[model samples]
Target: EAGVTQSPTHLIKTRGQQVTLRCSPISGHTSVYWYQQALGLGLQFLLWYDEGEERNRGNFPPRFSGRQFPNYSSELNVNALELEDSALYLCASVPTGYSNQPQHFGDGTRLSIL
Candidate 1:
């Protein structure tokens, strides 16, 4: 089974821009989660989507959002991106009906603000 993979590996942007990140979950997984690992943010859960619908979201602003495709792949969208937003975006996954399982992590898409 293929493990999770993230695109762009790294991204750089100025403040007040938009950024999009992608992720592909492992085979047979039905849920995907997004987490932001900023210097002070630690590993904060950004969003969770399952079966093509959003299941949960963290305390982040409305600018942080994402969606899951039918194939279980996912994308994260951030608008009006700020310098503080610069962080490593990680994607995680779990099998359907197994929320208790620790999620497998991607190498993460590093976002930088210039």
Candidate 2:
């Protein structure tokens, strides 16, 4: 089975702009999560989607949102982007109804703000 895949690998955006990051979870998985890893801050959970429904979100503002597709792929959208938003965005996945299973991570998408 294939692991999760992230697109672009790198993203450049200006302040106040919007950016969308994509992720495709492993086959047979139904849960997708988004996280941000910045220089100072440790890994912070951004969003969680299971079975095409948003399950939870972190302390981020409303501008941080995402959705899971029917095929189990996911998209993370950042609106009103800020310089602080520049970070490595990671996506992970585990099978549905199996929350205890370890989530496998994909290569993160590095976002840089100009």
Candidate 3:
């Protein structure tokens, strides 16, 4: 089966700029998970968008938000980007009611802030 896919493999932006990262989950998946991996840091859960609603979110600031579409694709939006926001933004997906199952992840979109 095809794995999750993320768009714009790489992106560059300046501080205060806003960016949107897109993700398409594997076929049959209904939930999307977003994580941010900063330099020298482990993956940090950013948010979870499922079905068509914003389900749960991490301790990130309000500048971070996301949404799920009817097709199960998801988008992560970052406002007022900062240098520290530069990192690999990963997207994962899992089938509904299969929370116990491991989530499939994409290569991730690399965001760089200058």
Cα RMSD of all models vs. native, in order, equals: 1.0, 1.0, 1.0
Per candidate, the number of residue pairs that clash is 0, 0, 0
Output the better candidate (1/3) by TM-score. 3
> What is the model-wide C-alpha lDDT for candidate 1?
0.91
lDDT (C-alpha) at residue 89 in model 2: 98
Per-model lDDT: 0.91, 0.92, 0.94
* Highest lDDT against the true fold, candidate: 3
lDDT (tens digit, per residue) of candidate 1 on 43-64:
9989998889999999999999
Write out the backbone clash pairs for model 3.
none
lDDT of 3 by residue, 1-114 (tens): 899999989999999999999999999999999999998899999998778888889999999998899999999999999999999999999998345779999999999999
Off by over 4 Å in 3: none
**Residue 27 displacement (Å), model 1:** 1.0
* Residues 73-110 of candidate 2: C-alpha lDDT, one tens digit per residue: 99999999999998999999998836578989999999
Relative to the true structure, candidate 1 reaches a TM of 0.95
Q: What are the runs in model 1 whose C-alpha is more than 4 Å off?
A: none
Ranking by lDDT: 3, 2, 1
TM-score of each: 0.95, 0.96, 0.96
